[model samples]
Target: MGNIYAGVDLGGTTVKLGLLTDEASLIRKWEIPTRKDDGGKQVIPDIAASIKKNMEEEGIRFSELAGAGLGVPGPIRQDGYLEVCVNIGPGMRDMNPVKDLSGLLGGIPVKGGNDANVAALGEMWQGGGKGYRDVVAVTLGTGVGGGVILDGHIVAGSKGMGGEIGHMVMDWDWKEAEVCNCGNRGCLEQIASATGIARHARIFMRESDRPSVLRDLQRVTARDVFDAAKAGDGLAEDVADYCMMYLARAMAYVSQVVDPEIFVIGGGVSRAGQYLLDLIKEHYDPLIKLTRGKAKLALARLGNDAGIYGAAKMVIDEREK
Candidate 1:
């Protein structure tokens, strides 16, 4: 029964809104499709409307909210401005999310951050790293995104551009990766992302003599590869193995660099379950030279609610400090 707070996770395709108590307890949550075609301009107004509707129907007062914590795809500038969002189109490049949304959201203070960082904070504060201080959270989706929690605080670099692990180089051989949407080439994102997994499977299907059950499906997905691997199909196994190896190598790489107490994996492809985690452990076990047994990888516990929880957490932690 404390002051209510709001957390919004804005993606290219959807916007997830959560209402929470100051204690991070979930009150009510909802999601709506994001209209990316109109550019970043449209999302703010839609969010404002949603908040207004919720106030009328749910009896939540806007003034009771301490602030709103927001998560958006792409790099965020320090003032909660959008620096780049490939999935949402180029219009977000110079968009000021805090300025726009605050105007629409009824003068509530807004703390903006990169989606991955928010998700990481979500996990750290109430999900996987609840009792821990140091952790690294990664989302394996259409593209890879990462967040680093160091010494109990979210690590936002000078301009809020910190903790972008997907851009880390995993393959020097690919040499100047294929120019990612972020304008970087040869990023681990091109290999470890969900889309990357599907892309890899597509190429394997074309060249490999290995037969796949996915051949008949209109589109082969990371899930299809997992299903195929379960069915004993070699092509599926190959794709799974390749993705796992890349993930494992990446985990090993992170272990060497961050040496966090845990590595939490979430996102669409993460549902692949043990097939993915086991592979990461398999590689992480042998290659990591930092310590004999200091780090462990765990699945993210919050699911989709982490963002809202993390958002509310921002207020609670800030007050404590």
Candidate 2:
């Protein structure tokens, strides 16, 4: 039998796992509840047990496995050590996940990376950025998250905080912006994320007496705003334009650094589809004066599965080397 690779995407609520062939084709995939009791100490052991059980069920042997890769939610050191994974648990702070996981799997080589970075890798491998090695992936969910890929490898940076595009300060004036989850005001996450969209919608509705279809709904959501804009609601369109402008400006700043060939937009809000891409491009094009061409923008294809695919690809790439 050909060699297979294991991938794990560890989240606070669940741990997603996948088995893939050497070519990065997934053979099977599954998940397990994350036991975060005891400060996430059981997370690694549980992952190890799940992989072993699945391998047994499939009649696969350890010798035929390339190794395992993990996508963690927090910052990771260059040496595969975690600085602190707040979502996982308190015990995960300052621990070497790669070393611990490798030991648990009987010395099987294990690699770990920030979940966003790993997801970016997944997109480059099989999703929107498939043809491009240098790419930037931006996730516009409740909060913003990003990953930077340079020369087909993740730019983890010195503190594994590379590709943290969401936290970029966009507005310095606190009076006009709300504080972000990071305890900062005017972060890109505060203006460009799904939550930010909803927040902007509320502000627009309150500040203006302009008629908006969005006013009919008791609760306003990012989707509601986008749908209303598509229906020609003037206020909704303004809100959408505002959100995209900030996002575009952020990408323009990023271009000065890595200048990726493409920007893959993912996460819940990206479901807005082509309209969102068009809106972003319309705003982004004018901001870049020196770059030869405007950066390409595309929606992420893998959805939630990007992390697992990228995780498996991590191990596969290592084995190939």
Candidate 3:
């Protein structure tokens, strides 16, 4: 056999792993529970054990493996170290996972990157943005996440904050804006994320006695609002429009800076499908008049698997060099 690569998408609840050939063909993929106890100290060991076990089952020796790459949830310093992964555990703060994980895995080459950034790279490499070198990936999950790829490389920035499109300020005056987890008010994430979408729906229902199908549900989800809007609920439509407006505005700002060829929309809320893309483009087109029709907007193809593909791609690229 030639060489194999391992990709690891390390999330707060689960650690997703993928074994891929040097040619980027994924042979096997699996997941393991993320043990957050002991400040996430067991996470690395568990990941190492899992990779080894899987390799053994495949009858591939460790020597045939090329390298491993990890996608972390928190900010990654330029030195291949994570500043602090709050969702994973407190003990993982300022940890050098790239170096430690490599040691555990018998010193095979290793690389690491931010989860969102790696996801963007994945989409650019083998997913929605496959043909595009300059791409921006936006994930509308519980909170908004983003990754920027310029010339087929991740722009992680000095502090790994380059592609932080979610935290982009949307509400300048903080008027009618709630505080974000980043301790800011008016972030795009506060209005465009799934949590933000649901929050807006609740606010609309509470502020206006608008007869919305969403009013029937005790808990309003982003999907509920989208479904209601699609079902012709005026109130839900307005709420959804409000959310997309902020996302479009943020995209316009991003366009002025990087001018990516396409924007890949991902995450749970993206399940809203083309309707969501239409809403964003409807609002987005008017904002960036000069760059009209230049940047195409589409949905992400890989879904949750994008991260592992991206993580593996990182190692593959290194090996190729």
The weakest ten consecutive residues by lDDT in model 3 span 286-295
Top lDDT: which candidate number?
Answer: 3
Model 3, span 275-301: residue lDDT tens: 999999999888887843658998999
lDDT of each: 0.78, 0.90, 0.90
Residue-level lDDT tens digits of model 1 in 10-120? 887899988877767788899988877666567778887886687657787667766777888877876777767777876677788877877787676777878788889
Q: Would you estimate the TM-scores of all the predictions? A: 0.88, 0.97, 0.97
For candidate 1, the 10 contiguous residues with the lowest summed lDDT are 175-184
lDDT of 1 at 160: 72
Candidate 1 RMSD to the real structure: 2.6
Error of 3 at 122 (Å): 0.9
lDDT accuracy of residue 49 in candidate 2: 90
State how far residue 162 of model 3 sits from its true place (Å).
1.5
